[model samples]
Target: MSHSRFESIGAYLPSKRVTTEELVSQLQETPEFDLERITGVKERRFRDTTPENGEDSFALALKAVQDCLSRSQYAAEDLDVIISCSITRSKDRTKMYMEPSFAGAIARTLGAREDTISFDLSNACAGMMSGVYILDRMIRSGAVKRGIVVSGEAITPIAETAVNEISSKYDLQFASLTVGDSGAAVVLDESVDESDRIHYIELTTASEFSHLCLGMPSDKTAGVALYTDNRKMHNEARFLLWTDTQRNFMEEQGLTFKDEGFDYIIHHQFGAAAIPYMNAIAEREFGHPMPPDLNVIEKYGNTSSTSHFIVLHDQLSQQSIPTGSKVLMIPAASGVVGGFLSTTISSLKV
Candidate 1:
């Protein structure tokens, strides 16, 4: 069986930077908590909505894919699959699309072969990792030679709603204010050796806690909104779902957490405080200190499905993570989903 690895990575952050203070100043009622201190989001990127730019979900995906392809050995015509894992599917200004499938649209735009498999999947913020998992399995099974897992999140509309509707610091919509816009893509193909390959990836969903966070048309507004019970979603038990699942998986393989030898760990950029707390819990549960945590939340906030790849691309771009470093990515998404992805990246570059 062939092991799959990341062949290339790409990310695009909008040029418009909105500071936390600027974002909170729009709130009708001043929040009691320190937004920047709690979220570690001093600023975030807002997509350019100008008619000339047209940087919607589709456009964002296109730009990231272009960047990825620029670094990849394969062209669009050589790709066997394209998976779109974006939660927000806006194609036009505030206009959401579900029909022709974002994957199909991207494939057609990029001029991929007609036989190239294309589809869209949504698993909340775990969407992109879920895409990688599926593609990795497909490659291992020899179902395809190569594929692209891509997401373009134009997710700030929820923040707009939060600014308009939040009544206090305790409002469920408060969490929505942390979101930013971004596009990220990764090309995956068979690995030649263990030095550059995805060792394992797994995801689990605890449906009972699915109600803790939800995105829907606003109950009392003109746009979409996100309602997240951060108190419940970021609790100790909720965080344990990831460590516990990984622990079981490791035991089944006769391995310990430290046996993986990860050089860096990347968590979903939900909040600055929540990540350290999650890592502390992991240390207690796994009986080992975690690898260094990497994140861009202070500048990019939570970019939803694209968060992990964005962090990877950022670190690679800055040459902070060496080529052969093993990285661990943990996903915490709505649907109360949790997962761990371990990989050693060597040839992948942003």
Candidate 2:
């Protein structure tokens, strides 16, 4: 079987950035709370109704896709598959769009061939990673030669809803306040060499803990809201969530972390503090220091499925990552979904 790897990546954040202090003013009776110190998010971007850039999720997605193609070896019409995996959807950020399928809509707008397979996938913050997993399988099986897994996240509605509904600093929905609006796209194609291939993509769901976090309509607001049990969902025990399976897989395959040749680990951009914690746990599981963890949460906050790709795009643009680098993309989402993708980015055009 062949391998699949990311060919190019593109991302966009709203021009209007809101500082942590500024966002505090919008919350009700939260004067004692300090978001910047707590989450390490200095500021975050939120999309607004502006002619400069379209405010809707679809518009953001289209722009991101166009930019991704501009950097990739393929054109929009060359994509054999298009997957849209966003936590939120549409111009009306609150209403989820499933009928036309955001993937098909993007393919149509981009003038992809009629034979292009397009659809949407939802896996909480792991949506784009899940899309990548599916496309990897398709490409390796010769079902598709090239594809894109993209997301345009308008998740700030949850924060807006939280600020209005929470009366105290102890609100469970507080995590939602750390999100920003962003769009990210990745162009994936068959790997042409050993160093440019995806070694593995894995996703494991601990559905038993699913009740600890949820996204639903706010009772006091007109927008959607996210509720999370921080104590229950992000405790020391959470490290065991993925390690059990990973340990067994390592033993079964007789493969070690060093053998994987991972130079960096791009984790879910949830918060500034979370990355180190996750790395400590991962290093313990690997019996060695894991690659330096990479993050962009300080500026972009959590953009759900777009988080990993956003960080990747930023790092590459900064030349923080060089060719022939091996990377591990990890996900830590609400479904207690935890997984890792090991790939060599030496082949990614960036």
Could you say which candidate leads in lDDT? 1
Over 1-350, each residue of candidate 2 has an lDDT whose tens digit, in order, gives: 89998888988887989887777787777745566876888889998865654487887787788888888888888899999998788755435677889998899889999999999998999999999999999999999999999999888878888877878868888888899998999989998887887888889998888999899887676778899987687766775776666766777889887777678988788766656776788778778788787888888888888989999999998889989899988888888898878888885555
User: What TM-score fits each model?
Assistant: 0.99, 0.95
Mind giving the per-residue lDDT tens digits that candidate 1 earns over 1-350?
Answer: 78999999888888999999998999888888898999999999999978787679888888999999999999999999999999999996667899889999999999999999999999999999999999999999999999999999999999998988988657999888899999999999999989999999999999988999999999998989998999889899899899999999999999998898889999999999999999999999999999999999999999999999999999898999997899999999999999899999888875
Q: Candidate 2 versus the native: TM-score?
A: 0.95
Question: Total clashing residue pairs per candidate?
Answer: 0, 1
Query: Could you tell me the C-alpha RMSD of candidate 1 in Å?
Result: 0.8
